[model samples]
Target: MTTLPQFALTVLGLLFCAGDVAALALLLTWQERAPSPDARRLRLLRGVLPASALLLALLLLAVVQLALL
Candidate 1:
């Protein structure tokens, strides 16, 4: 019952989510090894990025689902 556009949108959303996760993973690993004094800023980013990405991806998927309906 799924159309091509719907399928594509789902894939896009998953990819976006995966990309954000990968980028965050890379940042975490790199930051851990690097000597940095801005640990507080990193902690703030660690809190913010994933939540924002999840919200945006969910919003995109919601819009796509509404379009299909």
Candidate 2:
């Protein structure tokens, strides 16, 4: 029972981070034909990177807690 939240959070966080990375990769490719990426896209990437980092940190914390249990 105690493990349920930890497990769920870990899985969800990983999925979120993975999706963010994939999106960022796809967005980067969009700049290949241009001299620079659009300002809007850059702003979006900036927002996503921080969110992914925070989620990854949470996921790591959850894994550590699960291991300690």
Candidate 3:
């Protein structure tokens, strides 16, 4: 029988990664005003990029554990 913690982890991991990916798509395709290279670099250095990277790292860790289990 599946336990609650496993089920919740699966749900939360997928949701977190999906949201992170969607945010990346939106940022990459933004049409309102194109961000300059410097602006993009600054944005990454400041917050969004690093945070997304962390999300990816966390997701990878979760998937690896899920697979081992």
Candidate 4:
């Protein structure tokens, strides 16, 4: 299968980093308005999980890009 070039992967990583920051801000804002501890935790997790996943994915992409080079 074809793979993305290192430069492209690097750009994608940057974009993901920006997205993660935004997600964190939104998560914190949501947490402040949450009604209960359980609800707060759930909302925080909901915001965090996807950002974490994206970070992991970006890490993997970097690794793959390195391997290709």
Candidate 5:
């Protein structure tokens, strides 16, 4: 199979990085001070965010920047 063009790959990497940053921010700051009614949902998100960040990290790292030849 043909590889994606360099620009497409770079875009994918940026998206992954953005998602990871957003998740990291939510995990660190947004949930700390908010007093919401749905404690159960908040707990669920706490569990989910770390895993999502890890996945995004892996995806972002897998984008090899090999086009600078």
Candidate 6:
């Protein structure tokens, strides 16, 4: 099987990380506008942020590994 190049993987990982950052920013902005934001919404955002971070980390690691190869 052919393997993809490192630079490509790194770029892809960065794109994913950027998306996560964007989502987090949107959530923060929404929270600021909310008048007594719903507890459930806050809880969901709490969960989403960590999960997204984890995903970004994993992708970054993959990119690094590919680069090293």
Candidate 1's residue-wise lDDT over 1-69, tens digit each? 668877787777667666756766765666566456587467547854666576667666765665665
lDDT of 5 by residue, 1-69 (tens): 335575676677677767767766676565555576476468548765666668666755655442341
Collision count of model 4: 0
Q: List the residue pairs that clash in candidate 5.
A: none
lDDT values for all models: 0.65, 0.62, 0.68, 0.68, 0.62, 0.65
Q: In model 2, where is the ten-residue run with the lowest total lDDT?
A: 27-36
- Which candidate number maximizes lDDT? 4
Q: lDDT tens digits, residues 1-69, model 3?
A: 667888887777777767767776665455223468776667656666666677678767767766665
lDDT of 6 by residue, 33-57 (tens): 6566585477557765676577667
Candidate 2, residues 7-53, lDDT tens digits: the string is 78767766765675676566555544455568556655675457656
Q: Answer with 5 or 6, whichever has the higher lDDT.
A: 6
Residue 29, model 1: lDDT of 64
Compared with the true structure, model 3 gives a TM-score of: 0.50
TM-score per candidate: 0.50, 0.48, 0.50, 0.45, 0.45, 0.49
Query: Where does candidate 4 stray beyond 4 Å?
Result: 1-4, 35-69
Clashes of each: 0, 0, 0, 0, 0, 0
RMSD to the hidden true structure, all candidates: 5.2, 5.5, 3.6, 5.3, 5.7, 4.6
Worst 10 residues of 4 by lDDT: 1-10
Worst 10 residues of 5 by lDDT: 60-69
List ranges where model 2 is wrong by over 4 Å: 35-69
Off by over 4 Å in 3: 2-20, 23-34
Give a tens-digit lDDT track for model 4, residues 1-69.
335665676677667667756766775676779899888788668865676677667756755665665
Summing lDDT over every window of 10 consecutive residues in candidate 1, give the lowest-scoring window. Answer: 28-37
Worst 10-residue lDDT window, candidate 6: 1-10
Better of 2 and 3 by TM-score: 3
